[model samples]
Target: MSIMASRPVPRDDASWRRRRLGLFSVCLAALLLPICFSGGAVATPAIGAALHGSALEMRWITSAFMLAFGGCLMAAGACADAFGRKRIFLLGVGCLLLTSLALAFSRSALAVDWLRALQGVSAAATLAGGGASLAQDFDGHARARAYGLLGTTFGVGLAFGPLLAGLLIVRFGWQGVFAATAVVAALALVIGTRGMRESRDPAATGLDWPGTLSFTGALASFTYGVIQAPALGATAPEVIGALAFAVVLAVAFVAIERRVAHPMLDLTLFRYVRFIGVQLLPVATSCCYIVLLVLLPLRFIGVHGDSEVTAGLRMTALSLPMLVVPFVATQLARRIPSGVLCSTGLVLAAAGLAWLARTVGAPDTGVLCPALWPMLLIGAGSAMPWGLMDGLSVSVVPTDRAGMAMGIFNTTRVASEGVMLALVGAVLIALIGAQLPDMPGAVAPDVAREAVNRLVAGDMHGAMARAPAWGEAALRSAYEHAFATLLDRLAIVTLLCAIVVFACLSGKTRSGATDTADLGEPSTDTATP
Candidate 1:
């Protein structure tokens, strides 16, 4: 390494000030991006009407952005490391700002979807290297503080996005939300370009287009099948074809990663069980997370007859823990026992689901009681692993392979989330089939059709398309049943994740001796850090 590669200059007022501004830039971008990732789930009823799309397509609106956003992260991260972190991050913010502006003008579903894809591209470029940037700028103790702050910012983003979206959609309509995001992104971009310093570990990066393409294709193919499987039958020719393509592409991704000079991911990260397992939960946990996150809002707006503002506010209550717990957890992360944290939190998450299930049959406000405690637990539990898992995921790899390892880590979480959401949607579809007023096989033509048609035509904007007065009665019943069933599934996943984490830490107790030496490369994901 040349002296230039590790340059040291005066660290003064201007340098310090810009670093602070850069942090602000990254955090704002992080918050803005998730709204797109969430796909207006909170405002689905109204937005669905405005966009002239069905309830199902609303799910896809968010899911599609996740694919592009989370799917192509490795390539973006590598680009950051290769070209320069500050440069790529700024470029991503620019793209996000432009796409948000474009989205505000979008009329058709396709246009919104495409702009979101662009948003994902920009988000990945800006965010993948963000944590590393913080770690770079601050001293050791301050690095941890910065991490806690970053987590708080993300929690706030995740917490308030739906709430904000819901209110914006109700007061000014959905376009207002996009307009706000555009403004936020623009502000972040300008600050980042002027304030952020460049960061690169020159040795960690090189062009790896083939690796990027193969991995992305695998994720894209699989996610497509998952998203389509519930609406289109799993056995449908197109669904089957996508599934097949996914398998083949995934296998080829592994093979190419093995032979490439600058492989996008190092295949060896899996040897460490902790990183491997924690990443898996993001997928599994996310399945339940997405369902509840999407479903609660739907129930509030569509079934309970809450206004979008009211619905969004209730959901915000759910996200409050997501905002607060992570910062505190990040601070205690080094000192606390991860096993206890994850185990207890998982229990809390499961309990929250169970409580939610029990209260599902009640009106919207009733569910709040059971829902509140669990939200806190789930948020705290999930936050415990973020710093530890991420730290472990990359530190074990060589500096040169860090980008690929981070990429792999992120992809696991994102891809798993895609699969889990698909799974839940399939289950929900099956449940809905049974609940329909007519024969189960005939979905659109069922007895529910004429009434549904009125809603679809925008006649029942206030009354959930004039669904029966008993509709809440019926819908709440379905929610109770489905949510209970889903809670059981989550319990199983939580237990499994806990068991896996426990098994990985079967003997080792003490933490903090990071395994950095003699470690090899990581396997997959466009999430290269």
Candidate 2:
């Protein structure tokens, strides 16, 4: 029997109360993911300052968490189904509480990094188990609303995380940020223990151990290679070995998935053209919107010398559109074809990126004024597909494989975010390195490279100390030049992705109908979260 079918329906008033309480607990736990994600970015410079970490070490503060969270999500979901959702959910929340508490007291950057990775593993379990629990508890309209609230909770966390973290940091230092998440996690644990029920899939197969290990290893290896390249040199033996190992592990993962009885990822899903198009939506947003959540904070607080509070307040322009624009896009999807609506939104974002690139480095313009409109445009544009992609993930696939499709789509969405963050940081570092030699008061090539690494790592004081010849003004100018170039390249990439998405999605339908007919599936109330 299916998992949901096996669970007895709640009939009594007390059972319903427990279900509601379970959902609140799940949502409470869900809020921690984004809070940790965005808040970590704001906390990184401070962490480095306090811990006396290097550029690559400082990057790990955020990277380790994201990479671990993304890599383990599929495995976590499988475990949730094979064991019991409530069992996994409680374990996850309990671990999260422990990790957050540990992070608050950690003395070293390396300790924080390792703890962050553990925290991410816990988060993956929490999300996978909590989402599965909700799926089992609700059906039809109720399921839709439950997931909707889950999505909104995530949005709220992303929108205000920096601001909240900034306030906490100002009042109580970096530890306050982790302490805040720990407090919320404690609440989630208490409620979940009191209310959540056990449920599991009777027909679930053995976990894909090989696939899980290989996939996680591949992502970690690849991200490490990328993030360390600028510091270790592209030709360094360690960088070369890591990249080569990543390729081998990736090949092994695909082979394992193809051979396994119940694969973590069904390779067959890639055969669908629309599935390919749907997956691109996340990649597009990762470039245009998600990367900014990390990079912009570094620019404002680290490079431009704004206070953490000012930087967080400035970030609201980039994140606030997430709260309102997705609803507008959903309403418009009823009239416009999904492909067109999505492509148009990307086009707007591309234009904004290009605009921001041109204006961001203008010396005379004020900090917030130069980037404000572009940030709004990019946020609003990216929000167009944010709500619809989840529904499209299932609708484009056969009904029997909808579950696999959703899992794959979410994994791609999240895994790509971690990969892109690493890739963009690498690219920005390279661009900055290239600009350093040409600036006035330039130092030796080796010294310049070290300074660039420190600059991009969000250690402005350390960077200045490294290259005393290049005053703060010259260092900032070079960084501004490199940042503008990086944005231009990102804009081009986003535009190309838009074209590919439009082409793949155009003139396709479930029953040989127009795009508008199929588009309605994603707009309906019954759509998946």
Best by TM-score: 2
Roughly what TM-score does model 2 have, to 2 decimal places?
Answer: 0.93
Error of 2 at 108 (Å): 1.0
Candidate 2 weakest ten by summed lDDT: 511-520
Q: Candidate 2 — which residues are off by over 4 angstroms? A: 1-11, 363-368, 438-446, 508-529
Give the whole-model CA lDDT for all candidates, comma-separated: 0.64, 0.87
Residue 233's C-alpha lDDT in candidate 1?
64
TM-score of each: 0.85, 0.93
For model 1, residues 144-258, the per-residue Cα lDDT tens digits are 6677677677767777877788778867787888888888988988888887888887676565888888888888888778666665666889999998999999899899988
Q: Write candidate 2's Cα lDDT for 1-529 as tens digits.
A: 7998788766786788898999999999988999999999999999989998877778888889989999999999999999999999999999999999999999999999999999989999999999999998889888989998998888888888898998999999999999999999999999998888899999889479999999999999999999888887899899999999999999999999999888999998787777789999999999999999999888888888777888888788888888888778777777777778788889889999999998877653444567888988998888888877887788776666788888898888888999999999999988877776565555766677677887887889989998888789888988999999999999999999999889877754443212323443454434332
The lDDT, on a scale of 0 to 1, for candidate 1 is: 0.64
